[model samples]
Target: MRWWDVEALMPLERELFGDTAWSAEMFWSELSHPETRWYVVAENPETTDVLGYAGLLAPGLEADVQTVAVAPHAQGQGIGRGLLDALIHQARERAATSLLLEVRADNEAAIKLYSARGFERIAIRRRYYQPGDIDAWVMRLRPLT
Candidate 1:
């Protein structure tokens, strides 16, 4: 995504992630390293509103799904899957042999989506999230092909 999209994405980020939402500087930092990072945003065709966004970081043979978020109103409409597909494609482009991600354990829908896309739970970080003490599930997908 371009630097211009950062401002447009802030509201959505806060809405989706609440206390853990990323700041504009964080997005800028991620965007600055385009050589090893890939990020995309989905916009409403009519209003141009940010519907979803996803990012991937591929520094070597392994890539990480940095973040993925879909607006609540836009969920269940394939936006998340499409974003994920973009990340997977980007990972492959970078010759990433595997993709990894960490998701809050209570996010059942996200976990199901990752599982359906071939990611398997590799471990769990106890109470990885703050304030609420939520666990985080670490998942991985190998043979990116």
Candidate 2:
């Protein structure tokens, strides 16, 4: 993602995540740490519309999957997988020995996606999500051989 994409990215973020969505300033702060961060966006080729966005933070041998969101109309079209793949690639590029992420316990689809991508449950963060009693499953993809 570039400086210009923030304008288009924030709206989709709010639509997918609602009140807890990351603010514009938060994105700026993340981008400021390019040495340890990588973010990417997918767009409609014809209209140049934002379809999805994902970010990764690799600090040392560990990498965290910070966020992955897809436009409502664009879900189930491999955009999420593509974004995830990009993150995994970026993590490997950054010399991350393994990758980790957290997903809401209720989000089976996302959990399935991550599981299929080699992430395995390692722990749980109780009541990790706000405004309710939702929990988060902390998953990790083991180090590559």
Candidate 3:
């Protein structure tokens, strides 16, 4: 995603993630690592509105799905899937042998999405999300073959 997109992306980030939303500085920091990081923003084909976004960080043969989000109005429209596919493609391009991600266990839809994409639950982190007691599921997806 371009630097210009961060301003537009932050509101959606807050809307969806609430208190756990990332800050502008965090986005900036992630963006600064272009060699190891990749991020994409999905825009409305007609209106050019930011519909969703995803990010991946690849260091050597290991990669992580840093973030993925679809606007409330844009969910179930294949945007999330598209974003996810893009991330996988990016990881593959970087020769990532495995990809990892953490999803809040309570987020069933997200879990289903990742599961459908072949991610397997590997572990559970006890109350990983702060400001409340929410467990997180650590999931892994092996080399895309």
Candidate 4:
């Protein structure tokens, strides 16, 4: 995602994730990180307004999905799935052997989406999230030969 998309993405982040939203500075850093393999902003094909974004970090043979978020108003419209597919494709193209991610245990929709995309629950991080101290489920997907 470009620097200009940060404003639009930040608002969406607040809507979908509340207090857990990533700051503009964080997005900037991720975009500029050398380890970041890909960061994409999904826009309306016709209007070109940013609706979602996904990021991937490759630090060796493994690729980690740093984030995948869709605007609250745009949820259920296949945006998240599309972004995820793009990120996974990029990881595979980079020769990443596995893709890993973490999702809040209470996020059923996210869990379902990850499962549908071939990610399996591999472990859990106890109290990985703050405020309410929610647990996080670690999931992974192996690259297909």
The best candidate by TM-score is 1
- RMSD for each model, in Å, please? 0.6, 0.9, 0.8, 1.5
- Those runs of model 3 whose alpha carbons end farther than 4 Å from true positions after fitting are none
lDDT of 1 at 49: 96
In terms of lDDT, the best-performing candidate is 1
Q: Give the C-alpha miss distance for residue 101 in model 4, angstroms.
A: 0.2
Order of quality (lDDT): 1, 3, 2, 4
User: Tens digit of lDDT per residue, candidate 3, span 1-145?
Assistant: 9888999889999999999999988999999999999999999989988999999999989899999999999898989999999999999999999999999999999999999999999999999998788999999999675
TM-score of each: 0.98, 0.97, 0.97, 0.91
- 130 in model 1: Cα distance from truth in Å? 1.3
Model 4, 3: alpha-carbon shift in Å?
A: 1.7
Candidate 1 segments whose C-alpha is farther than 4 A from its true place = none
Off by over 4 Å in 2: none
Model 4 lDDT, residue 30, Cα: 81
lDDT of 1 by residue, 1-145 (tens): 9999999999999988889999999999999999999999999999999999999999999999999999999999999999999999999999999999999999999999999999999999999988699999999999897
| Local distance difference test values of all predictions, in order | 0.96, 0.92, 0.94, 0.87
lDDT of 2 at 101: 96
For residues 1-78, write the lDDT of model 4, one tens digit per residue.
777888877877787778887899988888787555679999888987779999999876899999998877788999
Between prediction 1 and prediction 4, the one with superior TM-score is: 1
